[model samples]
Target chain A: MARAAVKAQAAEPLDGAERILQILSESARLFATTGYDGTSMRDIAEACGISKSLLYHHFKDKDEIYARITLGSTRELYQFVFDRLPEGARPIERIRGFMVATGEYFQRYRWAWVASTTAFWNDPEQRRQKERMMWRDRYENLLRGLIQAAIEAGELRPLDVPLAGRLILSSLNWMHRWYKPEKGMSAPQIADAYFDMILNGLKVEG
Target chain B: MARAAVKAQAAEPLDGAERILQILSESARLFATTGYDGTSMRDIAEACGISKSLLYHHFKDKDEIYARITLGSTRELYQFVFDRLPEGARPIERIRGFMVATGEYFQRYRWAWVASTTAFWNDPEQRRQKERMMWRDRYENLLRGLIQAAIEAGELRPLDVPLAGRLILSSLNWMHRWYKPEKGMSAPQIADAYFDMILNGLKVEG
Candidate 1:
């Protein structure tokens, strides 16, 4: 209790944006570990080293915080990948760009990325739900568009565009299930490996 | 309440094995939709149309039900895939066999598959956890071993075996996120499409 009080005192002086970021980071870590239903506002407050009132002042409830973290982080992901792909670049390069950027972002915000996947979006928060789906759709469509372009450019063979998009997304999105930052291969290396396999069939060239 | 009683009356007439299967099916669906924490034993009982006492008679608690659902279903999956794969099958055929069997099992037991992925294994149920992890490892090793054999047979180029295994799993496992039975493509069709992409590069061959 004393330690929590000390921590709360220390947190009180941070600027609003930094405090919010800290709250989000800590809450995401908690949510990723304990799950959405298992986590409560009190838990987030304690985890953030802030008092309940202070936590509530920034966000009304757990759902709002979850929505913020999921939607905000997703928007950042879309922008990060979008900005990395250069104009007039080949479709294949854009695909590469998307994979690399996603790996970097995922590694940097591993907690939030994991939490975003697990977040329960079932409530009647229609506005946030619609916005969240928009971001998700945008992120997915970006890859699908790149695949479509690649097919048209004769870089990729004509295929089912949606399934191809799903294949790429699956390889990247499922990383949260097993990819650990401190363990085996780093995210970019794995992404590169996947890119290699996707670009070149596993079969011998002969 | 009358409907629930009538449902319970109907459930009572089943044999022990059939009653257990009904309990597992209802529990898996509830656990899939509402999540583990969000679901209660009472909810399971109501969903199964069984009395709380009767539900407790079969499974001690929610954890046991979850363990039974995840581990038992996984065991069945391993056996199903193993049975489909012949002993002297070539490495590529084993890979195809694994993928197709997985799609079929996933379609047949979609709720259990989804529940297994989301089931929290954090508690100190060490024995069940160990058994669960063992089944999971066995399942993953089967795929990895197939990839190793493919490389050895000169059927495929040498690559990171574990990453290759994960690529196949990622594509198939992520289906639970979006693929719907009532929707666009069947699971086997999607698996076949993924197989084609993995076997042949997305690029237009020169």
Candidate 2:
């Protein structure tokens, strides 16, 4: 009760953006562990230490909270990876950037990522078509485009670009399911194993 | 209506094993498409052309249906791969066998795999612990062990065996998400791409 009062007091003077951020962070934590379907708006309100009406004043419902968080997080993730790239980074380095960025991002925002796993899109064909491109597809295409560029430059061998992109992303994505901090492999170190295998190739030279 | 009637008649004379197989197969198909939470006993009965009492007579509930199908299927999948392993086959071929077997199995029994995604265990600590090992961890351990064997025999490079297993299995596990039989990549063909990439690695030789 005391902590709730303090949190409410701390949030009271903050602007709408800060209040929303606080709400989203708390909502993300809930969604990651309990799942989206398992959570309720009332639960979010309680976690926020705000009234249901106050939570609604910020966002209409749980869906809105989920959409805002996922879209915002994905946009930020893409930016984080792109922002770190050296102006003339080699193809290998660029690929490394992607794998490392993805692994670290999943590690940092696991709950949000897990929450995003639930199916949320339900709309007409055309709208769903456009929604498909918004985040997940765009992320995949970004990886595919990098692989294509590398192959064109002869920095990487010719392989099926789309398949290769999916393969690398698959490995990285599954890390969220099994990665443990206690296992002694940092996100970068885990990423390094994948990066090294991809760059070095697995075959022994004759 | 006629087809359901025919299926019901077909099962009338079957032994318990065949009757159970029929129920599990139909249930797996339903669970794959409609999802476990979405599927109901009545729906399974309608699909199987059996009464609710008859369905209950065979299995207690949805959870029983799920466990039977998943365990039976996983056991079969393991057997399928192991049966195909030739004496003195190279380490790479053995790995290929796992990938192809997994891809084809997912292609064939995708609904069962999807159904197994939901939680079924409800026991206190120890049962849940065993449940975890019974399915996912056991599978991961199997792959990791194969990778470790390859590494020990110097048939493969020394690297993180656990990471490699997850990476390979991830690509295979993810097939149900995007695999389309009509899209030109057969299960074996898709597995080939993964088998090739993982075995040869993706980087071009200098």
Candidate 3:
């Protein structure tokens, strides 16, 4: 009995992690549909074909699962942006690449991207603060580098890099809220529109 | 007893609407911080110094309240956008005025704007579809007019009016997700940046 109990205990965590992933995936779908406060652990568990106890065995609580989902998204976003920075590329080319990469990332992980940015506004205490800091540092660093490069290359007009960064990031980040995959406008199409708008001013040139 | 009961019942709805508004305001604050699914009607009632029964007397349910909040926002937005169409103004002046008005609306109703847009993505079956239809109609009409006027007046290049409208609206609509009043960037300032980028194109003329 003791040996069987030890083996069972060891197997539980592995089972728990798998269950947790299932719960989170279902929860994300529900949360995306119902809003976060509208969903519950029971809902997640029911969707996963498991009990609440099994759900808790893996996640500890709702916020943990939420954090995991967002962290996974952020990790993937960071990798997508950082991994594709070509060595010694021109500033304009680099910005274009970043825009394309951003569009592609959202195409694949659109729901995750939506939840992290919008849902972060709803988190509390330490989790909210930590997530905000992480996002700020990550985005600010990437933007600052691009802006500095653009200015040095005389590709961009003189502007406060951080402020310009925030403006550009805010405009891009807002895409997930309104972009629909079925809306005839593909990810690349939307990115191209944005690129043209940003690169060329709206007024007709003589 | 019957007369007193009738009086009480009639008065109840008036009281209920007021109470519901209070509950919604508190719920918005909480939901804006903790997320919609993360909050409960019990939590909202508790925060409002009311009982669950009293809360229920005001709202049929949480979804009812959510729907009301979004509808209210939509009504306000529609009024803001359409109430000031200047038939005699220059195209540039009209566009600039619209941008300014939009920026001010965002600054004043930031929470409601965020909540409603967030709900658009998170609640598709019940609320989002209707909201999207409303949004698309409003946007298409407004942009179609603006683009037509600009083209006739020899201002803007001949572009797909609906597409131009979506592009412009997308930039403005995305502002609520990241525009913090405390961030030293006023709504007008951000609007100016966006307006400049859109109106002037980013390329340096020889």
Candidate 4:
């Protein structure tokens, strides 16, 4: 075959790392739609066009795959948002940046975000659960810390930091239930709308 | 046996309706913790201290039990909120009442609320899913209607009603992830806090 024709073939072989990523991506889609418990190794293998035995070679079982996807995606989300936030920005701006960055990341990886958030937590993998909880705490704490700084800086009124954090996170997290990229507003635009609503309040000025 | 003594026995015979409610309640608890696919008819029967055959007699299978719990609880939730809201109240107050009533209902029936919200939607029962979606639309429309009234009445600024509605509902819906009655604030109190936050905004007045 000519070099161009060979390169253009539909069955170009994926390297080990690329193949693993493809598996994880496809698995996330299945998990998002069918749920963690509803999905199986055979189903994931089929989705990835890999043999079940090959999938098993990379991960022991569905639980392991779920754990890997959830942990990795959550960590990536945290890092993605963290990197986008301006270091020297005002507290309010940083909070806005955080929300916007998160929404962007969520939109880019919709399936992964849904799979991570909706992953079955009550499964028997206690150690994995603990790790997941740690990441969860870190994620919550990041937002809470920003709220605390804003409160102390007098940009915001004194309020329950955790409650405020949850409020902001709630709006972002629940986007999976209704948001569609093709519908109208992009994720960051929706986030900005939420931020404006939150910052300005809904009540008419006296 | 004496009537009082017999009544004091733990295994007093429950009427049919009461027995069904008990089964639903127990099944809700299981479904909340173990998820829909993870839970089984046998597990529910074991939880309720009833025979599997008896459980099956009441419902055809786990899906029926789930559909019954979800539909019934969601309807109850809607009615509960509707009845508690004041007819003559301003849109803002009506909104507050809705949130508080929902929180109270959620706290009182935490297991059922969790089970209903987390019920597996991808299951084969299209009819139940349709019913569930109808209730969901009614629930969303109730909030959206109030928001539209608020905007028209000049109590609130012109905003995207659906977006505003989702922002409020998100805070309320996400409560199941963390709220606990014994920890600190009651559900209504937390709802009030959220309402205050959303109404007053976070930024300090100039």
C-alpha displacement of B136 in model 2, angstroms? 3.3
Predicted complex 1: CAPRI docking category: medium
Model 2: docking quality category: acceptable
List pairs with backbone clashes in candidate 2. Answer: none
lDDT of 3 by residue, B1-206 (tens): 32233234334444644354455556666677887899899987776677799888778887887766666555566666566556688886677666766776666555566666664335546665576568647744765687678877878776656656655676678777556677577776777676776676544443
lDDT per model vs. reference: 0.79, 0.70, 0.65, 0.79
lDDT tens digits, residues A39-157, model 2? 99998888767889989898998888877676655655676566765558887778888888887766655555554543432223564345545867778888888888888888889
Candidate 4: which stretches are off by over 4 Å? A1-26, A30-67, A120-123, B1-27, B30-66, B120-123
* Per-residue error (Å), model 3, residue A64: 8.5
* Tens digit per residue, CA lDDT, model 4, B63-174: 7787788677777677778888889999999999989998887876666777777634344667766877788888889989998999999999999999999999999999
What does candidate 1's lDDT look like per residue over A102-160, in tens digits?
Answer: 88777655666766676343436687677878988999999999999999999999989
Tell me the TM-score of model 1.
Answer: 0.77
Q: lDDT tens digits, residues B91-157, model 2?
A: 7677777788777666555555555543332224565446545756666676777778787777788
TM-score of each: 0.77, 0.75, 0.65, 0.77
Q: Which model scores highest in DockQ? A: 4
- Off by more than 4 A, model 1: A1-27, A30-66, A120-124, B1-23, B30-66, B120-124
Q: Which ten residues in a row have the lowest lDDT in candidate 3 chain B?
A: B1-10
